[model samples]
Every structure is written in C-alpha cells, then in structure tokens.
Target chain A: MIEAKNVNFYYGNFHALKNISMQMEANTVTAFIGPSGCGKSTFLRILNRMNDLIDDTHLAGECLIDGQNIYDKSVQVDELRKKVGMVFQKPNPFPKSIFENVAYGLRVNSMGDKSFIAGRVEESLRGAALWEEVKDKLKKSAFELSGGQQQRLCIARALAISPSILLMDEPASALDPISTSKIEELMYALKQKYTIVIVTHNMQQAARVSDKTGFFMLGELVEYCDTKKMFLNPDKAQTQNYITGKFG
Target chain B: MKHTERELQSLKEEVSQMWKLVLSQLEKAKQSYFSGDIELAREIASREKRVDAFELKIDSDCENYIALFSPVAVDLRLVLSLMKISSTLERIGDFSEGIARHVIEEDCNRMPPQMLEDLQLDRMFDMLTGMLSDSFVALESENTKLAGRILAKDKEIDAMYCNSIALIDRFLSENPSFIHCGLKTLLLIRKLERIGDHCGNIVEEIVFYVDAKVLKHGAKQNKE
Candidate 1:
C-alpha cells in the first residue's frame, strides 16, 4: 500500500539515496538487505516523515500511501505516524507498568476511557503475542520482563493504536536466537493484518520471512525479486555475491 | 584478503584432476577385461586408494570453504553440489574396483564364450563411457540442455541392462556349468548400470548449476 517513485534523498548534498523507487504491496512482508549505510533505514523512515525530524535533510520524491502523497503539505504528519507505526532496532519501551506501556498510545491520542483502554491494552498485547506471559502481571513494570518479552511488549504498544502498516528497523537484532525466531514467526503472523517493511543484514532471515527481497548495495536497488529466486539464484552478480557472503 | 577466487580455482583444478584419474581407471579396467590381462585388473584394483584420497581431499576443501567463507548464490550451489557429486564419483570408483576384483578372481580366460561374445554388453559399456564423457563436458560448460540430454540417455543404458539380463538367463539355461561365470558377468553388468546412475547424478549436478533446480528423484517423470 506504499509506493515510492524516483525518490532522491539527501543529507545536505551528500546523496544518501539516489532515485530509488519501489512499490510495497498491501499485507506482505518486504525485506531490504544490504551492507550498513546503504540508506535502507533512511528510505524506511521517510515513509512516515520520520526523516522530517532531522535538520538539513532534503527529499525529492513522491511517497504515497493509499494513492495520496504523504509528503503533501495538506497531509497531517501526526495522522500519518498514527497510521504507520514503527519499532526501533533495540526495544525502547517506556519505563512504566506493563498495563500503562500498552495504554500509553491510547492515552496520548486522547483515547481516555478507563474500561475501554484496559480492553485495548489486553487486545494489543494479545495481538503482539505477549499477552499470555504478561497478562497476570499487567501492573509490573516493563523493565521486569526479559529482552524478548520487552520487545514484544514494545510491539504491543505500537499495535495499541491499530496501525495498518508497521515499519521495523532490525527489530530482532538485539535479541537471542529463540527470540529472533519468535519475532520472525510473529512477523509472518502479523502480515495477515499489517503490511511490514523490515530492513535486515541477515540474508537467511530475509529469505525466511519475506515474500519479496530487495538487494541493495551502495545506495542502489541492485535487484528485487521473489525471495526464493533471490536467495537461490539472484539475477545480479552483486546481489548474488552479497547474499552468498562472497563480499559485503 | 578474500581467497574465494583462489579457492574456487583450486577446487576446479582438484575436481578436474580427480575426474581424469577416475576416467583412466575405468579405461584400464575396460582394457584389462577385454585383453584378458589379470595384472591390469589387479593394478586397477590397487589404484582405488587414489580415488578415495581425492574424494576425501575435495570433501575437506568444500567443508573448509563453507565454514570460512559462507558462500552464497552460485558459489554456494557449486560447493554443495560438488560435495555430493564427489561422493558419487568415489562410489563409481568403488564399483569399478569391484568389477576388477571379480575379473581377477574368475580368471579372465575362463569366462564363457557366449558371455564374452555378447555384443549387447559391449554396447552398454560404450554407452556408459559416452554418458560419463558427456556429463564431464556438461559440468565443465554448465550446459543444462546437454545435461538433460545426457540424463535422457540413462534410460537407454537401463534398456541395455535389461537386455544383458535376458542374455545371461539364456546362456545359463543352455549351459548350467557356466553358472559362476554367468553370475560374474551379470555382476559386471550391474556395476556398469551403477556407473550409468553415477553419470546421471553428475548430470543432475550440472542441471543444478545451470538452472538452480535439484532434479534427482523422479526428474524425468516430472519433466513429462
């Protein structure tokens, strides 16, 4: 449901992304893979104007979500963010009670009905696959949970608002293998309800989770194709070399 | 420094040399079987160690590359397929040595006249040689079409194998005294049939390289 057309982005004349264009289909996981500093995260943040927070950053492109350019002055940034939720590389949960952590989004958006908010908190936690573990301890602080639990709690917090799109930047990188796999499984499950765009350095994870894979190198989209073909037999040598661990 | 290029070149050379050695052993065995030379058969049997050593070396090299480089794409496929194809080649070598051992024990001169003059057995050997040679070429060139063609030839070899079985049965009924020689000849045909299988495996590897598809079991059926 997101489309970027001939997108050129710059950090004060140091062209970070060059004429990058891609269409993200609704309710499918699309993974962006490349070496570090290839502008994958930059392109991801621009979807919801997260880049607008950075000074001296200029963008020239049409980033459309559901046929309307989000960069248009008429579009509201707050509304765009509410529609497009994000989770960071590390789990950044507010230091609050587990109940309040899920309630924070509804609270800020003035969704302030005591019993209604409680229902949403549980539902969001359930949606994020964190409800069973933390249901009895809703009043316990978020810090009491393990890294994986905390990350899932953070996901619950993001899902509290009922966003249609979820943008994840290396969501499982800081977690252990079991946690990583859980997150991968959660992503696969989440795709039926939300469109996901994940940027990963792990090629195998990208192959495992995504329906389509975009191989990026030095801020260029070298190849984009079905995940199986991309991993088994990529069309470009650069894509092949990068995925095979032959080169960075 | 990335030594992938160097490692790939080294692997290519090693596999090529191993192919040459195996082919020479097969040729020696065939010549010994034809020329009634028991010493040549014994020599082929003794040289089996070299084939075993080559297989071990290639296996270790592939494992080292995988552990160190974590190769992807075509490189990954090549290494993986090479590991499998190497073992198949080694097995084919063992079969060749088995045939040589049988010839040595049976005393080549005592082999029956009808079994020795059987033209179908000669045709099967010639087809086996052709399949091996074509597979080697297909692997070197990464020619998927040629590989498929070579794979199709395997059925012809199978038909020859069936023909040889019928010939053996006919000879056994006509002369019961030649049972030992008949069984040995039948076993030799079985060895050749196994060689055709190995050649089919090599063709499969070539197809994997060219098309990135694993077509080993029921490959022909699937194509149909």
Candidate 2:
C-alpha cells in the first residue's frame, strides 16, 4: 500500500510535481497517464527515493508506505528500494547469464544460501511468466532473449528481491504489440502478489489494465478515479478532453 | 478527426438515418390506416425490408466497432444505445408494416366510425407518431428532457388500447355481421399499442445514450 499526501516535488528551482495526492492499494494496479513531460515518472521515482540520486532535488510532503513516510530520515533508501522495486522503460539486464540476471537481486541483498537463491530465482522467473521459456537456457546471456523476454527477465530480477510493491515506468513502451500484451498480462498476474503502479502513454492500455487511473497534466493531478469511470466518463473536462484525444 | 470518433460519428449517422426511415414507414402506415390507400400500404410493406436491412447493418457496425476500437465512456454508451435503438426502431417498423397489412386486408368504410371514436384510434395514432418524433429529436439533440413526455404519451396509447377492448366487444355483440371487421379493428388498435411500446423502448435507449442511465425493465424513468 502506498499513499501520497500533498506531495510537492522539485528538481532545483523547477517544481516537477505539484500537490499530487493519490493512493495505490495492495494487490491492485494503478496507472498514471498523461502526455510526455507531465511528471508521472518524476512522481513514481519519488516513491522509492530514486529522485534522491539527482542533485539539488527536493520533496515536501509525505510519501507513505503503509503508515510510515518513506522520505523520513530514519528510513533507509536501500531498504525502501528493496520493499518497493522498480522496472524501467528499457529492459536493462546486467551483462550476465539469464539465471545470474535474476539471481543478482538476492545476491546483492545477501538474501539466501546458494540452493535458496537458485530456488528463488526459478520461482521469480515463474512469477514473471518467463521460466518455461528460458528453463533450458539458464546459462544463456540475457541479451540472447527477445525484447519481450528480456523485459520479463527484468521483471524476474525485480521480483527476486521479494518486494511488496512494483513500480513500472512505461515497461512495455518499447516492445511490440504482442510483447506489450504479454507484459500487460503479466501485470495482472503480478498484482496478485505485489502492489503495482504503472506509467503509460497508451490510454487504451490504461483502460484495459488498471483498477484505478490518475491523469496528470502540467505537473498536477487532473483526475484520479476508478479505471472504468476514468475511461467511461471521467469527472474532469480536461481529463475527458485528454482521454478522448481532443487535447490542444 | 480521431479514428474512434470518426467510427462513432458514422455509427450515429447510420442510426439516425434508420430512425428517420422508420418514421416514414410509420407515416405511410398511418395513411394506409386512415385513407385505406392500398398503394401507401404497399409502400410501407416494401420499406419494411429496408428497415430490416438497417437493423442488420447497424447491429453489425456496433459489433465491429466494439471489436476494432473498444470505445469507452460516452462513446461506449452511444454505440450500445445505437444497437438497442436500432432494434426498437425495427420493431416499430414491423408494427407499422403490420398495421398497413391490416389496412390491405380490410375495408376502411366498413368499420364503424363510432367504434373508432370510442377507441380514440385517430388520437392514439397521432400520439404514437408524436412520441416517435420526440424520441428522434431527443436522440439527435441528446436531450433526455424529452423522455418523461415520451413515456407519458405511451400511457395514453395504453389507455386507448384499454378502451378499445370493451368497444370491440360491444361492437361485435351489437353487429355480429361486422364481427370480422371488428376483430381486424381490434388487431389494428393492438398494433398501435405495440408501436407505442416500441416508442417507449426507443425513448429509454435515448436516455441511456444521453444520460448514461438505464431505463429498461421498468427502471425509474427519472428525466434529466
């Protein structure tokens, strides 16, 4: 469960997100949709403190997971990331074998013994729906897989850490439609175990995949509502115009 | 200019044209009923095929649009309403053709004028036509305000039908010689009542499209 209350974020003098307050429930898919540069990705990065890596950036307000604010000084950034894992738009697997790519998370976190890591790697791959495809090629380079398979491999790597939340930033934008569909399907499956937040430019995909949708515009949240209501009859005229493809 | 918008616009156009054609069919049916003009009855009968064709086309178009574009929100409501409205209009067209058939089968002069008056036949026919016109206007303008009046008009048609039952019984008892004509007259009134029912259906579909409210199955006809 993730909740943002009046979250205003900045990169130096530029305010990237303005008073964005939304809730992403456990075991559900929440999507952020808008035109490019509307600060959806900026807001997502703030969840796991990835924004903290940038210079001169600041956040003002609570980014709470469960009851505790993740931005609190007492909270460990590394530990926060372990609880909330992220997969980027590109599938950036390490220059390692498929098995090692998935095992990287467990190994970095010093999570388990060799047998435990191997078993967890298989389970995570199975959770990502990539295990059967790559079962015989565990030692093969991750680059040897197709774009879609590589994305799922990245998903397996993220899931290996046993994170309770998964933050996906345009995870399938670079893949073909078939691969995109597989990723979408995988999101539905993944939501049963992880609270998932996805950022997408495709309105139809948002309509199809999310339980709730937040439409962002000009660094502000224009509307946040049930996905059905958002796609069927959004409350705001700006949301209606944007989703209907009539935005000026 | 968007692809889904273009598809939805074309779907609305096709539905509107079918609606107007059904209205013409009703008009021809009314002419056949009043003037016993068999030629107008023939025209109404012939146009029934076109109405059936429109139903198939609109139904297919709605299905294809859903499959290809998967419209959401108001666009989704419009396509769904188009499907149901087209079906309701087709039924109206059928009843209109059925009325014309009754006209073709009987002599208008043989029917008792007093009985026609008692049943308020002319008044009921006019109300049905008016209801159809109101539904058409409501659908075109997306004005759900027209719904209450349209639904109320259907009750008048039903009352006329209720009055016709007794009138037919009395007419048949007094003039057993005109029993055949009386029964046919009763069927004509029943056809008008059915047309009224179809008009109510069309009005509900209009409301669904304009307001995103379901009015079928005796749902609250709360007007916008």
Candidate 3:
C-alpha cells in the first residue's frame, strides 16, 4: 500500500502541491486525471524520490510505502527506485537490443548469473506482453520496433527489476489508438502483480483502465472514487464539470 | 470564474423554454383534434419550427462549450445529457406536428365524441406531460429518487398505450364506419407513447446528474 498524509511539495517559493492526502492499495490501478500542471506527475515522482534530482525542491509530508517512510534519511534512494519502477510518457528505450533493455536493471544491480539474467529477461518480456512480437528479434536494437513495441519494451525493462509498484505518467499518450489499447490491456494484466499509479489527460482512458480515479486540480485532490462513479456520476460539482467536458 | 456554471445555467434555461413550447404544442394539438379547428392545428404545425430552432441552438452551444473549455466530470455529463435530451425533445415536437396534421386531414365533426372519451388518450397525454414536467424538475433539482420514480412511472404510460390499442379495436368492431377514425386515433396513441419514451430519456439524464451512474446499460460491475 502507498499512503500520502497531508502532503505539500514546494519548488523554491512556489507551492506546487497542496495539503493532499490519499491512500492507494496494493495490486490495483489508480489513475490521476486533470488538466496539465495539476501536480499529478510531481506526486507520482515523489513516491520513489524521483524529484530529488530537481533543484530547490522541498517536501513536508509523510509518504509511506509498505508502512515505511520512503523519505527517511536512512533509506537508500537507489534501492527505493529499484523497488518502485517508473515509465514515462514517451517510450524511452535504451540504445541496445530488446534483451539488453530488459536486462539493463539486473546488470546495473549486478543481480543473478548470466543464465539467470537471460531467464529473467524472457519472463519480463512475456509479462509485458511483448515476448511473441520481439522474441525472434531479441538481439535487435529496441529502436527497430514500432512505438507501441518500444513502449512494451520499456514496461519490460521496468518489470525486469521486479518492482512491487509501477508509476506511469501518460504511458500511452504518445502512442496510436491501437498501441494505447495494448498498453491499457498490459496495465490491466500488470495490476495483478504490481500496484500501478498512472497520470493521464484522457478521460475515457482513465474510465476504461483504472480501478480508482483521482481528479486533481491546481495541485489539490478534488475527489477520489471508483472509476465508474467518477466517470458516469461524480459527487462534486467541479468533478462532474471536468469529466463531462463542461470546463477544465 | 468557472465558465461551466454559467453554461450549465444557460443550458437549463434553454431546455426549460423548449419544454414550455412543446407542452403548448401538445395542448394546441388536443384542442384542434377535439374541436375540428384546422386553423389551430396549422398554427401548432408552424410553431414546430421554433422547437427545431431551439434544438439547433442548444446543440451548437454544447459543441462550443466542449470545444472551448475542455470540461470534465459533472459538467461534461450535463452537456452530453443535454445534447441527447434536446434531440429527443425535438423528435417529440415532430410527433406533435404529426398529430396536428392528422387532425387537419380527418373530418372530426362527424366522429363520435365517445370514441376519444373511451380511448382515455387524454389521460395518456396527461401522464406524458406530467412525466416530462417531473423529469425537468428532477434535472433542475438533481433529485435521484424522483428520477427513479419517474422511470418507474414509465410503465404506467406503457400500460395506457396497450389499453388504447384494445379500445381502438373495440371501437372498430362496434361501429365499422368508425374504422378510419380508429386508425387515426391509433396513430396518435403511438405518437403519445413515443413522447413517453422521450420523457423517459430525460429522466435518464436526471438520474445521471443525481447519481453519477449511467444506468443506460443497467448496473455496471463494481471495480472496487
């Protein structure tokens, strides 16, 4: 489980995230939806200290994963990241073969023998639903695959490390409809093993793929509820207005 | 500074005015049919243009709001439901005109008064009117329970429609000379039934507003 309690984030003097609080369960897909710059991406990155690389960023909230404070000084950022893998909006596959892309995490961590790495690579590729398409081309560079295939490869790389949580920021926004649907299907399948948090601008995508949906605006979590209720009928007037395309 | 509030209020007013015009047309159609007043029937038929215009204006407004604002959540549902409800209302207006045309064609003076009285079509019209009225009220008030009750009341209208068909058959058997009138009354009864359907559609919109559930395809499987 992931929990944020009265979380507030700041970039220099600008308050980027408000006193937001939410709990995301294990092995479920939770979607964050809003217009651009609503701080959904910021919140997602905070889970694994991805924002630590940014300059002048300050946080004053408890973000706990599996009942442990991820922001504690004693915690190792590198290990935290390995346990909580992330995929970005664009498919940023490494400049290497498909097999190497999946094997990159294990290589960096110096985990397992050569045969074990090979076995794990095939398993991650299969888990990402990209094994059949790229099985014969495992030795080929990731750039040789189409945008959709590359995205699946990226997901495979994320899963290669055996992360318990996956954070995706518009994982399918850069792909075509068919590819987007493929990613959605993958997310559905992945949720059985990995707790997933996604940020998206597409309302229909959120409605279709997510178990729970959180609507954010101006860095505040306006409402969080079941996806069906959020899309078909939202409780707050603001939430309803946003989903119905009445106004941003 | 939320533009959605203003647009939603405007949409409500537009639908309200359209409802008023539709109800007026329905009333005028009944008068012309019973009294053999061709002039009033023609007037009602001409007024259909206004309903059509309202539908067009509302459609354009909804499109503009969607294009300009990129609304989400309840505002989006309201716009979508309004677009559907407006089209349904326009179709209802067309049915009203159809009834007006039938009144103008048939020589109502020679028809038996007992024919209209026995069909209880006026009661059906009353129910249809009440249904539309309640649906509009539910929309404005965001009343889910009232909307659910309106949905249930649709069955009453459906039963009345079935009873009308039986009444027409009975009337035809008693006086074969009135077969033509019976057929025309049957067509009018069908139009009223369609109006009930539109009212039901409006009720559906209201339920969407109050509960945030589509209920369009029945209860969805809970993801939670």
DockQ of 2: 0.52
Ranking by TM-score: 2, 1, 3
Top-DockQ structure, candidate number? 1
Select the stronger candidate by TM-score from 1 and 2. Answer: 2
Candidate 1 residue lDDT tens string, B94-146: 98788788768865335555566673666676777778777788778877777
**DockQ of candidates 1 onward, in order?**
0.55, 0.52, 0.37
Q: Write the per-residue lDDT of candidate 2 for residues A1-248, one digit (tens) a residue.
A: 79999999888999989998988889999999998989999998988999889999989999999989998889999998899999999999999999999999899889999999999999999999999999999999999999999999999999999999999999999999999999999999899899999999888899889999999998999999999989877878888778767773
Instruction: For candidate 1, list the clashing residue pairs, or say none.
Output: A244-B72
In candidate 1, which residue ranges exceed 4 Å CA deviation? A132-146, B1-18, B46-71, B107-130, B140-183, B214-224
- How far off is residue B191 in model 2, in Å? 1.6
TM-score of chain B of each: 0.93, 0.95, 0.90
Worst 10 residues of 2 chain A by lDDT: A239-248
TM-score for each prediction? 0.84, 0.95, 0.72
Q: Can you write out model 3's per-residue Cα lDDT over A94-171, one digit (the tens) per residue?
A: 999999999999999999999999999999999999999989989999999999999999999999999999999999
What do the candidate models score in CA lDDT, each in turn?
0.85, 0.89, 0.86
* CAPRI quality band, candidate 1: medium
lDDT pick, better of 1 and 2: 2
